[model samples]
Target chain A: MSSSLTVERHPETRPPEQRTHRQVSTLPLVAPSVIALLLWMIVPLVMTIWFSFQRYNLLNPEAREFIGFGNFTFILSDPGFWISIGITILLVVSVLVITIGLGTLLAILFDQEFPGQGIARVLAISPFFVMPTVSALIWKNMLMHPVNGLFAQITRGLGLGAIDWFANFPLLAIIIIVSWEWLPFALLILLTAIQSLDHEQLEAAHMDGAKPLALFRFVMLPHLSRAIAVVAMIETIFFLTIFAEIFVTTGGGPGLATTNLAYYIFLKALLEFDVGGASAGGLIAVILANIVAIFLMRSVARNLDT
Target chain B: MGTLEMTRKNSRKWLWAVLGWLVACLLFFPIFWMFLTSFKTEVAAVATPPQLFFQPTLENYVEIQARADYLNYAFNSVAISVGSTILALLLAVPAAYAMSFFPTKRTKGTLMWMLSTKMLPSVGVLVPVYILCRETGLLDSRIGLIIIYTLINLPIVVWMIYSFFKEVPKEILEADRMDGASTQQELRHVLLPLALPGIASTALLSIILSWNEAFWSLNLTTADAAPLTAFIASFSSPQGLFWAKLSAASTLAIAPILIFGWFSQRQLVRGLTFGAVK
Candidate 1:
């Protein structure tokens, strides 16, 4: 096949005209997507930055004034802003730890030979597919309701008082719900990485009298580092912007208890009509996410070569 | 002694199997419970001890259908997801084709830049985009959502299709070119047919992501263009004792995407991780 293609291409190479034509056409072929993405990325970003520096509110559209750094100062000094930043960090870190740790364990479990393996795998991954609104509602009403929830029923059956999940442990509730949605993502990726591991290396380690812990630590851990990094970075990006689950479940509170930076910005923009403050908050979010995106982009760029 | 060892091994296998099954069931229980509750009456849905065995009824489904425009929302979801996916494909195929076959100094940077846009948190520009939508009367419109979805999924689509096109042997295209086939013919006859499966799975994954996109759908659409995500979110407020109806609504919202998701599990890992895992 290679020889025939090379022989056929020998005639086509005789013409410099067609080669230049193909090269010229490359720009037009790629121009549309590149231009569109460039506009999409730049326009809103510029507008957000501009708005962040002005004292603008949607309700009072006529009262636009350039109040440089005023919105930033106000947003920075707000108690809710500090609380939201804390919640955002806590939420992202907690969910990351839970998903990665649990995901690794589940991936290893599913790697073993078992009956109904395919069916179990399918079931395990279903939650990741469920829309965020539906998952939030299911957890909020069906599984976590103070009176009618399954946990309540179980507690009642076992002679203990039912815990009102959202009321008492709002952040933990959101964490559990978000973790449920993402744990499968981590599992699927890690499982793919594990399955790609060399079996001979493991056998050799076993032959060398390495116990299960040592083998996992030396061989499996090293192999899974790339996947683990990918999972951590990707999950951080998504977790930073987790809005719908909180929107549907707690509306960001029993009292701003579950409000992350994303929801806080949403509230400032839509509910309070504070565009300037929200834009400041929005810029802050962009900066926070960029910190993580830089790492993710570097890793993905490294993969581009192979 | 041999029999004892064999029994021990068999028991251990059973133990692992049981453990696996337990975890799977625990992970899947919320969905299963929702499915079960959707078929129950309002009274039965909220019954204490969680009625596991009740006479199943489609009353909630019927009520939701009668009261709300469930089909409208479903239609919007179908139209927006399908429309945006096709649009993304039209733009992505050419760009990915060029990037894969044609070597250039800037291609890698351009690809990385596209992905970096994806990492930009939607909230960062939510205020501006919302203002733009409101100004242009794109708010609560299908076209608005289609445009957004297309832009959002374009990077991933390009990446997926580029990877697929990379797998195609350059020899085939060169051979076709030598036969005096025009560029259109080469693409029409050689590329699309060869890349059909890749394109199809990419479309599938695109549909799933667009369908479950809750943030924009919720914030942008109020009633007219609300997709199933917004529809399910409408049940957030405790209006009546509508547990069964809410369950039914949630079930309807997720059913199609859930089925599509199961089929595209492998492509999902590939797409989400940008082929890093696969």
Candidate 2:
């Protein structure tokens, strides 16, 4: 199975002269990016791994000493670390569910014939272009503030008390903001896939007296499976390391309510100056991300063959 | 019976059109609200029931201009985003050309390896990179941030350009070779022209990504070198009654890129999904 997958994905290796030129000429052309990426990938990573085993802190530059997994043990035993891991998983999973669910519905909605479809699409995807800091601040101050926010105004108008969004629902707020940013991406991909569906099949099914639900279950859902898988894998890779939104809005606070693994490591490394502990946390993040990366790579590789 | 079916179909179409418009407005409300609030006065911006009509003011834009050097941050943003995009294209174009036309047994592995480098979370190497920047005296320099941006974006650029190059017919290059054209001559005379539109779109996407990149820009730069991302982030701290000013700054930071993004949505899906979706 593995061999066949490989054979299916890779193009046949034609003779060098027949394709372009000798391998020597092309090898040099490809060397720079490969070499830069190799160094970029290797140098800091090796340093991170090495730092994780030492008693190093940026505050005490001269007190460095070998500690041999001491940092890992400390981080593992820390409750904050576990909380962060839990929060990371929750954030990623929640955002994925919200974005995919809303995106699929939006894709179907936009697929219908409308008078101003093009303009509507252009407006709908605008949020994806806003910078993270801008979106976070807009949500925090303009929309979600307890007193002066739009939500607050609406609640008061209806004679209900205003709820402080960040203080009360920090993680959910972050998830909502992140989901808004990414929903356009999922919609664009899924809409493309839906548009590519064979119309003749849909027509035939309709002629056979299939109901809307039945048509969707039998025809549309099956066609969208690959696109859905692609969206899930790609969004997982990004949502695992969400930073800027949390950084700008809550600072991972209300006391760690929004602190995922990435912000947790940032706090250790930059704020507290604990290089050793942060490096250990960084390695753990690498491991977690790689689990998702493997699936994404396989899916992308499969797409390359066709 | 046929007239009744027509009436039902017409009503359904109207139903869908109304639903589509509603969803579009819901999705776009935040940005539209931001744009509207930018033109309101400070008191008007936070007013209850949200002022639908007010005397528009340029006071926020004027205040931002007089108090802060908005142009300086805008310059750095344009310089870094465009500069890194060009640098990445220089490195990526040749590499993509080689991998697409010359398929060695390891080419696929190499391409995937490049992509996997992107997957490694930037936080994983934040400490070492931070220390390296400090030690090398590159902590707050534009050049330093440009280099980081170039390195981070190189993989996507190479992949996007490679996909575009793959669409170029091999027979053209083979014909050039038959005419005894050197590699440089063939690339300059033949291949580059054919692939120009794809390359342009790829470059545009890279610029958009770099422009909106907040993590590194926020972390790596302080006062002198801060881009628009960092500039907007500085507004996160509570300042007494500056909603209008903040809105103006946010609008300025996102406007150019938003225009660019709308134009390149097709390339964005192709590049972002790594050609899997398109």
Candidate with the greatest DockQ versus the true structure? 2
lDDT of 2 by residue, B150-195 (tens): 9999999999999888877777777787899987899899999999
lDDT per residue for candidate 1 within B160-255, as digits (tens), equals 998888787778888898899988899899998999999999999999999999889998999999999999998888777688898898888888
Candidate 1 residue lDDT tens string, A55-136: 9998998999999999999999999999999999999999999999999989988887788988999899899999999999
- Score candidate 2 by lDDT: 0.89
The predictions' CA RMSDs to the true structure, in order, are 3.3, 3.0
On residues A21-123, what C-alpha lDDT tens digit does candidate 2 reach at each position? Answer: 3556888889899998999899999999999999999899799999999999999999999999999999999999999998988998888887898888888
